[model samples]
Each structure stands twice: as C-alpha cells, then as structure tokens.
Target: FMTLLIGSILLPVLVLVGDIVFMFVVVSAALGAVVMTIYGGFETGIEFCHRITMAVPETYWEMIFPSSFEEKSTNWILN
Candidate 1:
C-alpha cells in the first residue's frame, strides 16, 4: 500500500516534468526558425535589389527595344 501511494505521487511529477521539457524544446526551435527566416528574407531581398540595379539597362534594351538593336547594328555596318 505504501509503495502504491509513493508510485502514484511520483508518476504524475515525472509526467509533468517531461511535459515541461518538451514544451521548452519545441518553443526554442520555433523561435530559432523564425529568426532565421527573417534574416534570410532580408539577405535575399538585398541580393535581388543589387542584381536588378546592375542588370536593368541590359534587360530593358534587350526586351523592350529590338528595333534599337537593328538600328545600332546597321549603323555599325555602315561605319
């Protein structure tokens, strides 16, 4: 009877401790993921902005002004 009484009290305490530890681990992982995502987004945005600014003139002429390309080529040939 005494053993049963002790077991009953200890079992709940162990279960509670396990639950608390599990919650702590899960929360820590979630926080880490959120922080990484924010930093990753900022890094990607900066990289994309740099690439766009460097490449915009070339891209604009190629895609939006094919006639200009022909004019330049003909001028070069005539020269």
Candidate 2:
C-alpha cells in the first residue's frame, strides 16, 4: 500500500517534468515561425529557435533524455 501510494505521487511529477522539455521544443518551433514571419528569413528564424532550445536547463535535459542505464532493466528472464 505504501509503495503504491509513493508511486502514484512520483509518477505524475516525473511525467510533468519530462513534458516541460517537449513543451519547450514546441515553443522553439513557434518562435521560429514568428521570427521568420517578422524577419523574412529562414536563417534568422532558425538562429533564434536554436537559442531557446540551447537554453533549457541541464537538469531538465537529463530528465528529457535519460541514458539506457537510467531505465530499469526489461529483460525479465535475466532479472
């Protein structure tokens, strides 16, 4: 019961944090569109878009793309 309760609370937080990075990606794309519309050039639009993506916090990035070891093992037989 305790494990279930803990998992329930932590899972959503994990999901939400992961989604923030995706949200930034979408935001970056939108920024690019707006920039292109305003500046009338692909290069300037992409330059600003890259800036936003590059600005994502390092910790947030780790959450967005975890290494293989970060994930739990899935080979049931081996486990």
Candidate 3:
C-alpha cells in the first residue's frame, strides 16, 4: 500500500519533468536551425559580392562612381 501511494505521487512529477526536458530540447533545435540558416545566407551573399567585385574591372567602377575618379559623370543611364 505504501509503495502504491509513493509511486502515484512520484509518477506525475517524473512525467512533468520529462515534458519540460522535451520542450527545452525542441526549442533549442529550432533556434539552432534558424541561426544556421541565417549564417548560410550571409556566407552566400559575401561570396557573391566577392565574385562580382573581382570580376568587374576598374574602368567599370570609375564609370559607375565618377566621384571616386574626380571626373564628371558621363553615364547617361544614371544622369
């Protein structure tokens, strides 16, 4: 009879603790996935920008930003 009474009380507590642990693990996994996704996007953007800048010639930059060259803008598309 005493063991039955003890088990009844302890069983609920154990179940509640297990639920809390499960929730914590689920939330942690979700946050980790979000962070990894954002990191991946940033890495991709940086790589794309690096490629574009490296591939474009200096003349192209001067044409786009004439102020850097201390020259008047002749690009009609911008003007």
All candidates' lDDT scores? 0.58, 0.64, 0.60
Please give each candidate's TM-score.
Answer: 0.45, 0.42, 0.45
- What is residue 33's positional error in candidate 2, in angstroms? 1.9
Q: Please report the TM-score between candidate 1 and the true structure.
A: 0.45
How many clashes show up per model?
Answer: 0, 0, 0
TM-score winner, 2 or 3: 3
After TM-score superposition, the amount by which residue 69's alpha carbon in candidate 2 deviates from its true location, in angstroms, is: 27
Candidate 2 stretches greater than 4 Å from native: 42-79
- The C-alpha local distance difference test score for the whole of candidate 3 amounts to 0.60
Q: Order candidates by TM-score, high to low.
A: 1, 3, 2
TM-score of 2: 0.42
For 2-72, candidate 2 gives per-residue lDDT tens digits of 88876999788889988998898688679666967588777767766655554443575554664556232
lDDT of 1 by residue, 1-79 (tens): 8888778987889899999996986676556555655777867555544543433344546545545654344322111
